[model samples]
Target chain A: MDFLSVLQFAFVQRAFLGGCVIAVLCAVLGLFLVLRKMSLIGDGLSHVSFGAVALGLLANMSPLYVALPLVVLASFVILKLTEKGRLYGDAAIGIVSALGIAGGVILASVSRGFNVDLFSYLFGNILSIGNEELALAVALSAVVLVVVAVFYNDLLAVTFDEEYARVSGIKTTRVNMLLMALTAVTVVLAIRVVGIMLISALLILPAATALQLARGFKGALLISALTAVTAVVAGICVSIALDLPAGGAIVAVNLVFFLAALGFKKAAV
Target chain B: MSAVISAEQLSARYNSVDVLQEISFEASAGDYIGVAGPNGAGKTTLIKALLGLVDISGGSVKLFGESLQRFGQWHKVGYLPQRASFSLLFPASVKEIVGLGLLTQKRTPKRLSSGDAALIDAALELLGIGSLRKKLIGELSGGQQQRVLLARALVARPEVLFLDEPAAALDPQIRESFFDTIRALNRDARVTVLLVTHDIGEIGQHATKLLYVDKRVVFYGKFTDFCVSTEMTDFFGTHSQHLICHQHR
Candidate 1:
């Protein structure tokens, strides 16, 4: 189908809206994730989401609904473990991530109804998104956006230096917990467009690219959101034209934009 | 003279390693206390303990005669960490960074009072970086970045400021000027300053109290007493003589 014809389809429209919502949420939370050097935690959580979805299918429930709470729970556990005494942060992430992926693969193998449908969800099937899912993504993204806006200063201070944040009476621990919750929500929302495998790329690439072009938090957020939107729209178009997978196309577009930004920065210097 | 900070037998451990062992000291308001030690002598850990950045393994730390935990006087203390490795390459202007000092107050989003702006401007002026307010923090030299950090710490009008190797990366000329500015802040604003450094001779001249830490309190007394003490001679070894030579050179 032609681009206009694809746009005319309700499913295509829903998918595009879903991608846009995820893009916005990822772009916002990605700023902090990149700043705090926890971008890999996003990847880790997405893998955990995949496992949650598979477990949901086995239990005869809607995967997204089950996956949402499961991912949040897993993120909380990871954060708790890291915070408890002597557990190293990166080590906790790695251990949890490995187990999550393994559980997902095992669950998928034993499930009766698993097929290409499951495969599509693993890597994303934006064109297969429904109206309800789109609405859910939009609502979650709005809530996350509001939460981030309300706590921007605290998050900024915490991201820059936790010690300074604490000394300023910002409650660094509580802020960190809130940030992790936001990250979990953002990861779940992003699963529809980028899938579990390529989700962190969407989270990291746009923000990193924006950092190259912009010189402040507000500027970076604006440029990053714009970058994400551009990538989604362009990726959707290119995927439809070439009959390629939407998720891969979107990530490829994001990668290209990041490279372009890097080149531009180098040239400016 | 009221002590702004007082530590008694403060000990700290990190992952089973005793980073700081039984260190004790006190600093009154307007006192410039310089903490000197060799590498791995627990200098940074001692500062972190004072700032409550690390958990104390033993003893107590008091601020204004109350335990630090009970007082929870975060606003009264300002810290500039040793490293300035912000993820976003100086994405903030000097003004914004200094404005962060006001984060202790529960203000509404994007709302800056006229008083807040004036305070930021005053801090910038005090650090002599007023003209560089609009410049990005990453664009400045190491010395300038250190000044911006100091301004950020001072913008809140903190009673006690803890600096961890503030002049570590600055050029010799910039380091001298940085110390001069620090001295002026202590003198003019009556701000309590706790500085960690290896530059003993210069700090000896500038600081009122000297704390020589080597995983323990080797010596803690007046700077003059420390200068004449055999303990200072034994601990600093050639390092103290090198500092003195550099001052003359």
Candidate 2:
């Protein structure tokens, strides 16, 4: 199909708009993640989100609704476990992530007839987005954006120095929990656009790339959003043309941009 | 004057190791107290404990007459952590770094108001880096970065300021200037200061009171008393030698 024809389809329009919104939210949150050295948590949580989706499907419920609360609960568990020193930081993430993906694989195996649907979720099918999903994605992203804006200063202070933030009365614990909760929600919403396996790359790479060029917290947010937007648009166009998976293509584009940014930084130095 | 900070028999552990044991001290308002110890003597741990950043295994801490558990009163405290080098290319200006100090205060959603801007400018100017306000923090020299951090700590107009080795990496001239700046802040602003340092001689010269620690309190008294104490000589001899050996290797 021609590019214009693809744009004319309601499903395609929904996917495009949904991808844009998810891209912006993920990229902005990713800046804080990379700064806090929690990039791996993004990957781990995305896997958990996949398991939540599978569980929702198996229970015969709307996967999005079920996945939403499930992933948030799991993220809270991860945060709590780490804070309580029940597990070493990275090990906690790894253990939870492994269990999540394994559970998803087992669940999918039992539901044999939904293999194609599962595959689409694993690798993403942008053309499969519906109006309801689009609206939900837009609303969630807007909410995340508003929260970040309102608490931008607190977030920045906590990200840079937790001790200082606490001393300044910023309630670092509350802010951290809220950030993780938002991350889980964003991951669940992003599954339709970027899929489970590659969602973290979309969330992390654009922010990492933008950090190389942006100045402060505000600049980083703007640059990361723009970079994510560019990656999504280009990846969508290329994937559609080549009949390839959109999620993997988008991640590849992000990786390319990250490498280019590093090269640019090195050459400048 | 009321004590701004008081810790009695404070102890902390890391995993299975005892990092600090039976450490006790008190800082009254307008007191310039210097904490002197060899490496691993729990100087940093003490500061962290005071800030309620680390958990205490024993004893109690009070800040501004409130228990450390009641950290809602943290607004009265400020801290300057040791120089943690950032990537030289990290894209944040000095103004932004100092601006982060003001993040604890109530602020509007948009740009900072003129009054907030004035406060930031005053902090930068006080630290003698007004011209470097717009420059990237990563681009500054070691002394300049320390100054920026000090400025960040002072921006809050705190009642108590905790500085961790503020002159650890600076040159002699810069170190003197840094101490002068701190002394001025204590004198002019009447801000109570608790400084962590390894420079025993400098501490003796500048601090009103000296606290000597080596995983415990060896001594806590006036600087003159510390200078005359035999315990100071013994602790610095073995402890200081160990630190020098570690630094050389």
Per-residue CA lDDT of model 2 for A135-251, tens digit only, reads 888898999999988887787777776777787777788988989898999888888888888888977898899877776667878888988988888888888888788888888
Quantify all predictions' global Cα lDDT against the true fold: 0.84, 0.81
Off by over 4 Å in 1: A85-89, B88-90, B107-111, B227-249
Cα displacement (angstroms), candidate 2, residue A113, comes to 3.1
**Residue B58 accuracy (lDDT) in model 1:** 98
Question: Model 1: per-residue lDDT, tens digit, B1-249?
Answer: 557999998999987999888887888889898888879999998987877778999988888788878766666777888986675374677888888888776554635588999999998887778999988887887788888888889888788889999988788887777888888889998989999988776677788887888899888877666656675577567676446434421
Worst lDDT run of 10 residues, candidate 2 chain A, spans A112-121
Native-vs-model 1 lDDT?
A: 0.84
The DockQ assigned to candidate 1 is 0.51
